[model samples]
Every structure is written in structure tokens, then in C-alpha cells.
Target: MSDEIAVPPRQDNQQWLRWIQAQYGGPACIRRGKRLHDALAQLEQSLARFRQPGHDDDWLAMVRIRLGQLHALAGDWSKLEPLLDADSLRIVQQLYTDLQPQLRLPPAPDPRPDVLRTALQELQEAIAFFNRRWLRHLQSLDLSFYERLIADYNRYYLLEKECLLQSPRLARLGFQPLPSLTWQSLLGRFPLLPMPRLRNETSEH
Candidate 1:
């Protein structure tokens, strides 16, 4: 069924896969707590493909997400700022959305359970990897939105884990700690907020 997708005349399919893998490796390197430039270069190649028209949406989505990860890795606020556009932000939102149990544990008797698990794990690992790199960038941006984003992500992950824990069919799926960050820690590292607090201090008195 996938023979065609498996082999494209332009070789775009395979090359896209290779690029995604390279981007993935780049982020893994950052998570390993090593220098980030080499990985950044690999990610740049992945993103370069996006400049060409006619790229697949799924592939473009990956490139956008990978660029976000790369920006976070470099701690280049100026560059990272542009990469965190609505499309890239949506990718971040979907990372937690995909983890939803009803979505993952779909009624049994379905074939390819292993494939589903693999897909879920790959995304989870990507989010985890991104989170670690993102926290470093967040530390510098001092954005309240960053705090809210991380907290919401952590909450959703915990909720999803609990859902998995109660699934009799999937209970054997084991577990992993929820991703998180603290306000105190956030404050300690990045004392200034990226946004200014707005108050409706109107003269009513």
C-alpha cells in the first residue's frame, strides 16, 4: 500500500525523512546537554527545504517544529522570536493534545497498536527534548506566556499519564514523569518578564 510513498520519483519522500531524523538527532544532542551548534546546522538543512514551494504539509509542519527546537537550543532570542509563530506554537500545543488517552488508547481490537505506541513515544520524546531546551531559552525570555505554556503542558501530560494508568488494556504501558517547571525557579533565573503587566487602574475613587 505504501510502496509509492516508500519510493518517490523525486526522492523527496526519503530525503524528507532523512532531514527529520537529522533534526531529531540535533535536538537529542542538546538534551544530552552538549554544545548545540552542530545540531543547529543539521536543523538548518531541514528548514531549508521549506523555502522551496510544493513541500508536503506534514513535512513543512516538522520543519517548523524542528526550527523551534533549534532556536531554543541556540538561545538566540532574536532568531527564536520569529520561529515561535502561530504555526510553530500550534505544533507545541498538539504535542500535549496527541498524548490524550482517548486518542492513544482507541478502542481495542485495532491492528497496529505497536505503530501507534511508537508514534506516541516519538512525539513524547520530541516534546520532552524540546521542553528541556526551551526551558533554557525561557529562562532568558522571562515571558509569562512561557510559564503558562510549560505549566499547561505539564498538567496535560500528568492527566494523560493518569488516564493511561487506569486503562486495563494499556496499563502495561508503564510510565514516565510529567514535564514541569516552577515559578520560583523561573523567577530566580529570569527575573524580568518579557511582557509588561497591565492594570485597569482607572480613577474610580
Candidate 2:
């Protein structure tokens, strides 16, 4: 986006980072993305195409309409970063540190059947503990509003993209809808604490 429409970078605590989208960067409401501007420009072309030749279908009309709606949705978007509640990440990070293997080697499957079974049982308990702890942290976040916008974008982005490209095929290629910001998807941002992997011994032939 040009500096004319550009929003200044915001100052927040070090815990927050911007959402990543390689194709268009952040939301247009925040950065006024280049693709969004291009999409808006297509409205005139769609109107012009409707007036010419044998274009009786509503395809172009919907494309224009979606573009406008998508733009409006984006404009309503404020800084969605810091999307995560403050302190959530820090606590999760500390949890991860506490779960680290530290200097000790991870448990290995033992040759004795009883020892192997005990190790496996302990590992399962640790796995359950990690999952329960992680779930508690994830459930505490409030993603209802941002996720609603993501839901809206998933519904309309492709149609608006078709407007920008002027070709449905072009719009469909390499297109991936933004996922709703669920706790599961948020895992990509905040990682899970994991128990050490069991390294089973292999016999050399």
C-alpha cells in the first residue's frame, strides 16, 4: 500500500507479532494491501464488461459485489494482532521450558518386558498431562470476533479475487482460504509442550 493510505506501525509489547500471509501480508484495514487495492480497481472493469457484448450472466456482478463487501469487512478490521491475549504466550513459553528434556537423556524401551511396559505407561501419562495443560491455555483465549472475520473472509475472498483477476480460473489457482482462528490452528503460533520421544534400540545385522 502507498504511504498515502498507509497506517503507521503500531507499538505494542514485545509479546505480540503480526499475522503472516506471504501473498498479501496483513489485512488491508491495517496495511491497505496491494491486492486489495487491485481488487477495488476491478469494480470499474466489471461494470464496463457488463455493458459490452453478450455478458448477461450475474457472474461479473457478483464479483464486483463481493469485492465491495470484502473491502468493507477489511476496513472494519482493527489491529487483530496481539490477537492472542497478553501474557498467554509468556505462560505457554514457560510451560514449554519446564517440560524440556534438560541434560538427561530421554527414556528408552528396555529389553525386559516389565521395564518396557512401565516406561510406556509413564510416557502415556506425560502425553495426557501435556495435552490437558495445553488445552487449558488454548481455551482461555478469546478468538470469537477475529474468527468471525476469518469466517467472513473464507466466504467472500474467492469471489472478490475473481473480480481482481477477471478470470475464475486465475482466481482459483493457488488460492487458499484463510482458516478460522481456532485453537487448533493457533497451535501454529503457540506451540505445544511435548514429552521426550522414546528412542528404541535397534539390533545391528
Q: Against the hidden true structure, what lDDT does model 1 obtain? A: 0.38
The residue-by-residue lDDT of candidate 1 on 1-205, one tens digit each, is: 5444333235464575465456465323123223323443444455345333345622234323433333233333233223344544354445324322122222333124343333323434444444444456444543354345445443454454335245544633443433344544544543321211112222221
Q: What local distance difference test score does each model get? A: 0.38, 0.43
lDDT of residue 57 for candidate 1: 27
Give me the displacement of residue 96 in model 2, in angstroms: 11
Cα TM-score per model? 0.21, 0.32
Give the TM-score comparing model 1 with the true structure, all chains together.
0.21
Residue clash pairs of candidate 2: none
Please state the error at residue 114 of candidate 2 in Å. 20
